[model samples]
Target: MSDVVPVKLRPEILAQRAYKQGQPAPANSFKLSSNELPFAPLDSVVAAATGATEFNRYPDAAATKLRQALAEHYGLTAEQVLVGAGSVSLLYQAVLAAAGAGDEVMYPWRSFEAYPGMVTVAGASSVQVPLDRDSRVDLDAMLDAITDRTRLIIVCSPNNPTGTYTRQDEFERFLERVPSDLLVIADEAYIEFVTDTEALNATRLLADYPNLVIARTLSKAYGLAGLRVGYLLGNPRVLNAFNTTAIPFLVSAQAQAAALAVMQEADSVRARVNEITMRRDEVRRALIDQGWPIPESQANFVWLPCGELAERVDEILRQGGIVARTFPGDGIRVSIGEEASTSPLLAACARALERYPYLRREEAEAE
Candidate 1:
C-alpha cells in the first residue's frame, strides 16, 4: 500500500488503520478473542430492550433515565453523569472535547487499542507512555512524559489486553501531580472483574478532582456489548462539554432501557463477574505451573506475552480450537470464556510452549 491518497481525506486518517477486531472462531472452536461475557443477555434486559417499541421516536438525547440510574448507583446527582453509546464512544467524545490539532492526549501504550484511534480522530497528537516490565501502567513515567501541550491523560485500570492495573495510592499521587487544568480520564471498562481492593476507582475520587472523569460500560459485566451503553462520572461542567461533542442520540432508546434494566440486576452481574475472575485466576495459575510466563491478570482475560513468536502461537491456539486474540509481534490475549474453553486453551498453550521452548520460563532461564 502506497502512502498516497486518492482523495482529500486527512493524511493521518489515510495512514491510520481502523480498529481490527479479534478473529472469530470456527464453528467447532471457542471464541476467546473478544473479552465478552460468555453468558447471554438477561431475560429482563431483553424484555426491557424489546419494550422500547417506539423506534420512530428519537431516543432521549439527554439519556435522562439511564443517567439517573447510574448517578443513583454512584451516589451522585444526575448532573454529574453522562451516558453514551459505549465507554469507547464516551472516550472519543472526551478526547475531542479537550483536544485539537496542536494538543497531546496521553495514555499508557499497550493499554486500550482504541485510545490511539480516539486521539487520532480528535485531531490530537497521541503521547503513549510505555508500560512497565510487568505490563502495568507506569504512573511515574506518564507524569514525566507530561508537557505543556498535554490536554488529556487516560488511565485504563485492569488495562485491556494485559489486565494489569494502577493501585489507589500511587494513582492518587499521580493525580495530585498532574496539572489541575488538564483533563484526565480513568477508563474502567473492566472494573467489575477487579478483585484487588486497593485498585484505583476514579469515581470515588471524583469529588476531589473536578478535572477527572470516570468512564465505565455495561458492555462487559452486564452483557450489553451488543446494545452499546456506557457512561461517565465527572464534574457536571466537564461532562456537559463531552455531551456537546457526542453524536446526537448515540445511546439508542433500547440501549437505555436495557442499561436501566441491567442496573437492577447487580446481584446476578456480580455473580457472573465473580465466576470470570475465579476462572481467570485459575487459568493464570495453571499457565504458570506449566512454565508459561503468564502475568497476574485481575481482569477477565490473560495475556500471553509470546513476544516475536506471537503469530505462531496464535495459529497454534486456532489449531486447538481456541480463538484467542493475537497482537502479531506483541502477545496473545485469551479471554476467560466458558468453562468448556478451558481444556483446549491450556492444551494449546502447552503445545505452543513445547514447540517454542523459549517462551517457557524454565527454558528462558536455562539460556
Candidate 2:
C-alpha cells in the first residue's frame, strides 16, 4: 500500500482512518466486546424478514409502514418519524443537515466514539466537554461550551463505554438553558435497557422542545443490529431535514418487516430486555465486590476504569476467554453476556486486581 494517491481527496478524510469495530473473539471465548444481544431473534421477527421476498425491487424509500408503526407507538403523526439504516446513520444525517464549515457540533467527551468523526465528516468543528469526576456527562460544562457557531448538540444517555445516564431533571434544565434555535439530539440507543425510572427518556419532552429530536434503534434491546433498523422522532420539519440528507432506500425491505413484527411482539421483547438488565446488575455488583470502581450502568454493559492499565487488563480478560472492548489508556467495556460467562469474568477481574493492586479506586485515588 502506498501513501500517494492519483486523485484528490478531502485532507481530513485522508488523515482519518475508517471506523474500527470490536475485534472478533475466538470460538472458545465469550465475545463481550460489541455490546450485542446474546439471545436469538423471536420466531415471528425471523418469519417476517424471510417473508419479504422482493429482492429485485427497491425498498420503500420512505419506510412508510415502519414509520407509521413507530409514530403510532409514540402517539405522533407519521411525518415525525424518520427511519434509517441505524441510529448512527440517522446521527450522520442530522449532523450533515444541521452543520457545515465554520459551524460546530457539541457532545460529551468519552461518550460515543462516533461523535467526533461525524462532526469532522460534516466539515464542522467538534466541541467536546469533558465528563465529570464520576465519568458522567456534565450538563453544566456542556451548556458553558455552547457558542453561536454551535449548530447541534448530542446527549447520549447511558453513554456508551461509560454506561452512565443523565437524570431527567438535569436534562430538562439543560434543555431550558440551551438556545431554542439550536438542534439537540438525544441519542437514546440504549434506553431500552435502562431500569432507572428517573433517567432522561427525552421522548416525554419532545412536544415541549421543537429543537429536540430523539434517536433510537432496535439494535441492542430488540436484537435487530444485523438488520440496521433505527429511527428519529421529532417535529416533522426537523425530521424532514434529516430525511433529505439520507441516502434513499438505505433501510432494506427485510429490516422494515422485522421491525414491524418485533414491535408487535412487545411482551416477548420486554422479557428478553428484563433478563439482560438483571444480569447486567448482577455483573456490576460482583465487579464492585471485587474492588473494581465500576460505574452504575443503566445500559447492558459495565465499565472497568483501567486507566493506564487498560491494555494489560484486556490481556488478562482475554486469557480468561473473555473478549471485551478495550480502549488502550481509558477503560474496558464488558457486555453482560451469558450466565456461563460470569464466573470467568469475575475470575479474570480478580486476577487483574491481584496482579495490579493499585487499580482499585481507593488505591488509585491515594496515588
Clashing pairs in 2: none
Predicted candidate 2 versus true structure: per-residue lDDT over 115-144, tens digit per residue:
989899999999999889888989999999
Local accuracy by lDDT, each model = 0.90, 0.93
Q: Where is model 2 more than 4 Å wrong at Cα? A: none
**Model 1 / residue 36 / CA error / Å:** 0.8
Error of 2 at 217 (Å): 0.3
Best model number under lDDT: 2
Tens digit of lDDT per residue, candidate 1, span 188-288? 99999989999887877899999899999989988998888889999999999988998898889999999999989989999999999999999999999
* After superposition, candidate 1 runs with Cα above 4 Å error: 1-5, 363-367
lDDT of 2 at 150: 95
